[model samples]
Target: MKGYADRKDLPRFIAVFGCLLAAAILLGYVEMLIPIQIPIQGVKLGLANGAVLLMLYLFDAPSAWLLSILRILLSGFLFSSLMTILYSLAGGIFSLLVMTLLKKLRIFGIPGVSMAGAIAHNIGQLAVAALVLRSVESLLFYLPVLLVSGVVTGLVIGVIVRELLPKLTFLNNGGYQL
Candidate 1:
């Protein structure tokens, strides 16, 4: 069986993880300032997830998990309170799990996998927030809008990754380094 840490891709993993972390922090700040409201609360473009989707297709699960954790940590330190860390971590893990499962099942290829990850990430975060706030009502109104937004935004990010993957030769199967 292939162990998580045993995965041969290292340099590529580091590169992707770093990129994801930077993107997450940048987007986290942007989201904080703009704070898009969908008339429901906690619904907005998690544009940083673009990097997460890219990593999911380029590397393995553990690598993706590492990237997510790094992003949450960095974003927490830079943008908001440590309490926000829980929501971010939960969303990241949930997103990674969904993407990994979809990839295992051979779903809609890399782009589709990325989309699935983004969508799940949003839903997971919203669900956690609803639970924490003790406002089940928010979930009822928010879920559908989130689903639509997730699909659209996820697709855009997925497409971007798909196009960029070809030029990112470092991520090629044999080129990944530690």
Candidate 2:
């Protein structure tokens, strides 16, 4: 069995995770700078989610989960309400779950997998918002918009990952740790 002590790249994992965390935080901040808004309560392009999905492919579920939670918390502290943190958590977990399932099926190529994650992320966030607000209205109205944004962002990020994959040797060897 492969042991952590035997791996020369153990420090590399910590470095990568740290970098991923930084990237997520940066993305969250940049997202706040963008002017796009859904007028409705819980819709977003979720560009930062792209990073999370990419990490999922490079790393393991636990790493992706950690990244998501860290990103949500940091973003909440920086730009949103405590309540927003809950929505972010719901969306991140749901999206991660969707991507994990799709990765297992190997149905859609890498881009497809990313798109799937984005859509699920949107759905999950909307669901949580609806529940918390005690109104199905947002879920009903937000689904189509979120779905559309999810597909578009997913494809964009998918293309990026495809271009990036061949170049990153670390990701190529399943170098990610849980």
Candidate 3:
């Protein structure tokens, strides 16, 4: 119940990890298939993040953290470039840290935590963008727009996880001690 996986739950933990990883990758592919375009590049629905959130809530921070990194690497190799990997790695790390903190605080529900995580993701990505461009001002100009997009997309993913969690009662309760 403490969310750490024990020997008895190790197999289940691995299974959950594998399943979440698959879901994240599949969601990333789905996101790629969707043709939602914004004026600024790199803005996304963050569909894959849903699985990472689920892992965080269902198990523990380390589980979610691992999922986030693996998802980025796999999705990057499967669907994008080295730059894409770097950007995603940055965003994913920032997003997971904030989300884990908020979740630990118990101050916000999934929606609020997710929204904050999304903003963090944008900030992280923008930091990388600034580094790549060697221009902080240019990336700063995109902050407001990126924040707005993060709010919208993060809420979408949050609402979805909220709805989806209830349906997974088996996983939530009886699946494992992990």
Q: Best candidate per lDDT, number?
A: 3
Q: Write the per-residue lDDT of candidate 3 for residues 68-139, one digit (tens) a residue.
A: 999999989988999889999999999998999999898888888888899899999999989989998989
Q: Which is the better candidate, 1 or 2, if ranked by TM-score? A: 2
| Best of the two (2, 3) by TM-score | 3
Model 3 bad stretches (over 4 Å): 1-5, 175-178
lDDT of every predicted structure (CA atoms):
0.73, 0.75, 0.85
Per-residue lDDT for 1-178 in model 2, tens only?
1243477766776677778788878887887777976575555556677667666777666777878888889878888898878878887888888888888777778789888888888888888878877999767877887888888878888778767765664642655322
Candidate 2, residue 117: Cα displacement in angstroms equals 1.0
Model 1 lDDT per residue over 84-133, tens place: 88888888889889988997788477667777887788889888988888
| TM-score ranking from best candidate downward | 3, 2, 1
Which scores greater on TM-score, model 1 or model 3?
A: 3
Q: Candidate 3 at residue 106, lDDT? A: 86
| Rank order (by lDDT, best first) | 3, 2, 1
Best by TM-score: 3
- At residue 86, give the lDDT of candidate 2: 83
In order of appearance, the predictions have TM-scores of: 0.80, 0.85, 0.91
Clash pairs (backbone) in predicted model 3: none
lDDT of 2 at 74: 84
lDDT for 43 in candidate 3 is: 83
